[model samples]
Target: MAPMNIFDNTETAFQLKSDSELERAYFLFKMISMEPLVKIGSAVTKFALNVNLPVEGLIRSTVFDHFCGGVNERDCMGTVDRLHDVGVSSVLDFSVEGKEEDAQFDATANKVIELTLLSKNMEAMPFCVFKPTGFGRFKIYQKITENQALTENDKEEWKSIESRYDKVSKTAHASGIRLLIDAEESWMQDAADELCEKMMEKYNVDRPIVFNTLQCYRWDRLEYLKKLHQRAKAKGYKLGFKIVRGAYMEKENDRAIEKGYKSPICESKKATDDNFNEVLAYILNNLDDIELFIGTHNEYSSYLAMELMEQKGISKSDDRVWFGQLFGMSDHISFNLGAIGYNVAKYIPFGPVKDVMPYLIRRAEENTSVAGQTSRELTLLKKEKQRRKL
Candidate 1:
């Protein structure tokens, strides 16, 4: 009933550094936490992508450093090891973005398979994640969702999309790697959800190999989750569900307004948070039929889920439920949860720096928009700096 205090141990939370690394990490964190730097970096990324110019250097040194594991899988080995050392696992996310061609789609699918194989070979990497847009054209996805008839070319495109998912699902099943299909924008999401369902049916028979994301910020998502659970039960397969407060809120609302339709987004943050916690409760209570990944940065939601597990007498090591945070933004939450014996993983995104600039820019923009996020990071860095003076 009481609110969760995310920073219960304020002293330890602020102690990000020890003797040697204190000054350097503090300065880096302060620089990344600055509002103007994030704002300008976001603007430059948008401009560069619009004009088709290189943005690797600027992005790599700024937002990418704060958010992403590294620029490639090989580059991320050290990061994965460091997190593993501290008791957290890694979810390998190939961060390639904005691919619109058939060749690129096929390549992305193959890369995801390769990543799954790599994760299976590593003890520390437990999961792999992909975005449906990475392997399908957005317009094609929108058309499918709308039930529009397809031309020969469109049918072929859809076939390719199906083939890509099939390959990823099959590979993941073979590799013993859990695959998370991320939720996307509203227009394309219906098709994405359908594809994920198909994959789950094919791959999650004995164990949950494919997990579909549910964005609880959408007003319709609670009903959708219930329907998906019913379908999973009827099909005699366990459903893997990852819950999050939606990302793409502004874009979804803008599109809805432009098209003269009611927005799918919840009217306020409270509504979204309420739905998120409710979904968490449902999955935790029905753990036999469902596997859940609590993908959130919100402290209240995360701690509440943990408390629920305790109340249900679930073990801390239960693989049926896991917690995830993005690679860069919430080290306090991720590291502290890991330290407290939770099954936690950081979503470690990696790709060519230029290719992942869009992701990096979004991280910058999100940190700027989220209340107290930048200030919290700044305060932690300053506190660490002062601690080193002792």
Candidate 2:
């Protein structure tokens, strides 16, 4: 039989979308392609939601429908099933942002554990994700990283944070579900990294039950990956790496400039891509002690990963390697790769419309910042729609 070509089958890629859904997606990307409009529209949407204007329906049917799985987990079930039909797994993410109170922390932690419990025996939902700040305050992390001494009360608070993480990770491990600790900004990352390592030490004895997201756009991540693997090997644990090209590039640059320090990010996209691919190769070489999830929208990176797998003679369905993209974007990469019997999953973030505005704004900004991303989505979508009419 001929070798599977992978990632040119738009028919399977768009099988999940209807004619109207396809039109809406095309229109959405076309609008997002206009950078200025996305910025202005994001600001307008934020304002409208701030004062409790009645725009939920408008927002829900447009961008929310296009990007998010739904307003809640129950609302996301249909999307989960559709993705399963096409052989793609779902990594359900709670997309709500910006909560700081302790009660809020417990609530978010409960919801995350709830998500893990819900996916316990489900094949369609193979993984679940949680942001560190979702379960605890970000300032606490910032303070902890600043090397400041903690007071008696501060010590108690730190204990609470640890408990929260323990609860979530333990629940995921117990439920036989793999969990990802999403990466934050460089400033707050020290704590997230430490926590992930600790959890890996605990639950990753037999297999990788927890994963840490590594953003390769940062200049030091290649070295960081090396150090992480060294520690994992010395400590006798499996390290799960969900590697991406980094999301907060512009923000990282602005902060570094303001703070008068060299940027942590790479100077150019090529450098970031180079670092990413190199680290990925390193992971494949160490698959005995590592598992990898290549989370990228870059087609060449995807091709490179497949090539590496062939060179290494690893089975396409090897549990040690997987591919992931966010929901609603990169359909060609996700669905086409999945259809070819490779392990592929998409991050399907779901939450209330108003609460998820931050995520929506970031999605808009990402499409604008990443050159050709929006246009690429538009091109593949147009191809599929045209092919559909035949």
Candidate 3:
């Protein structure tokens, strides 16, 4: 049978969810499927939180609980242990977003360092993740990407950013944890890529300790990967990447049209899928030199990966390859693959309720935007609900 057929086993897919938890997930995806509801709900949630309405509990009990591991590391321990029991690993992602102050950057960096140290002793938690903008100002990265000359203050800020990157990456290397540095907007990604490559060179000597993300929705990423691979081979270091179909397509396209430049995103979803598959194949083919973390929610893509690995006689449990999805979504893929001895992980986001709202809201909005994703989630969840006679 095809690998995708395994995903139909909802019994294994949602083995961890209680009947009530399953119902909540079904309802959440139902809400997410309605685009207008998502928009209105997002605005209302933001307003309620802004006016200091006592809605954190409600938020925490609903979307926050379903999508995130917990509000802090201690709060997430139960989740870590539970996932580990089923052979799925966790990457504790600090999902707080939109902060720009230097102090906040330092705090985020320190949090990553703390998580790296914590993950060193936890079998379930194998990866630590943080956004590039989480460590510094987005404008500074934008300035660097645009090749604009920075003032002394900007240079100082850039230095501080580099220091944060080095500090976190060095800690991860020492702890023997793989650090996944997330990609952001196209304009700022160039600087992040350069910084991640620097970390890879410094720490990936013995193995891949630092992984950069490639948003394959962008037409240029495959070529960029090829070029980066050549550079890493020449420099005597391994390259690690977490490849995704990207998250900022609408924003990227809108910004390109507004600024009179070509859009970085592919022309259509088909093109993005093709590019993602191509990049996946490229990394799999060169597994000796490149370690891959396949971060996707599409079933076909996941099945294609499994097929390719089998065709090449690669072990299903290869350390160089991993499959990842978000914490709440795509349990079918995560759990089913884990059941079969694949290296699978869920990106478990955790932060304060208020701080993680932006990330949660984006996840909802992105779900609504991605054609068929929310509906597919709803369908699988409903199937599970029916199967359990709930």
State each model's CA lDDT, in order. 0.83, 0.89, 0.94
**Which residue pairs in model 2 clash with each other?**
none
lDDT of 3 by residue, 159-204 (tens): 9999999999999999999999999999998988888988999999
Give me candidate 3's TM-score against the actual structure: 0.99
The estimated TM-scores of all candidates read: 0.92, 0.97, 0.99
Higher-ranked by TM-score: 1 or 2: 2
lDDT of 3: 0.94
- List the candidates ranked by TM-score, beginning with the highest: 3, 2, 1
Against the hidden true structure, what lDDT does model 2 obtain?
A: 0.89
Positional deviation of residue 104's Cα in model 2 after best superposition, in angstroms: 1.1
Q: How accurate locally is residue 172 in candidate 1, as Cα lDDT from 0 to 100?
A: 90
Q: Lowest lDDT 10-mer window, candidate 1? A: 9-18
User: Tens digits of per-residue lDDT for model 2 on 1-390?
Assistant: 224455667888888889999999999999999989998999999999999999999999999998998889998899899898889999889987888788988888899899999999799887878898887778877777776787897778778888888888899899988888899898888877887889899999989989999999998998988998898888989989899998889889999999999999999999999999998999999999888989999988898889889888998899789999998899989998888888999999899899888998998899888998988889888988889889
User: Candidate 3: which stretches are off by over 4 Å?
Assistant: none
Q: What is candidate 2's CA lDDT for residue 7?
A: 62
Q: Report the error of model 3 at residue 4, Å.
A: 3.4
- Shift in Å, residue 34, candidate 3: 0.6
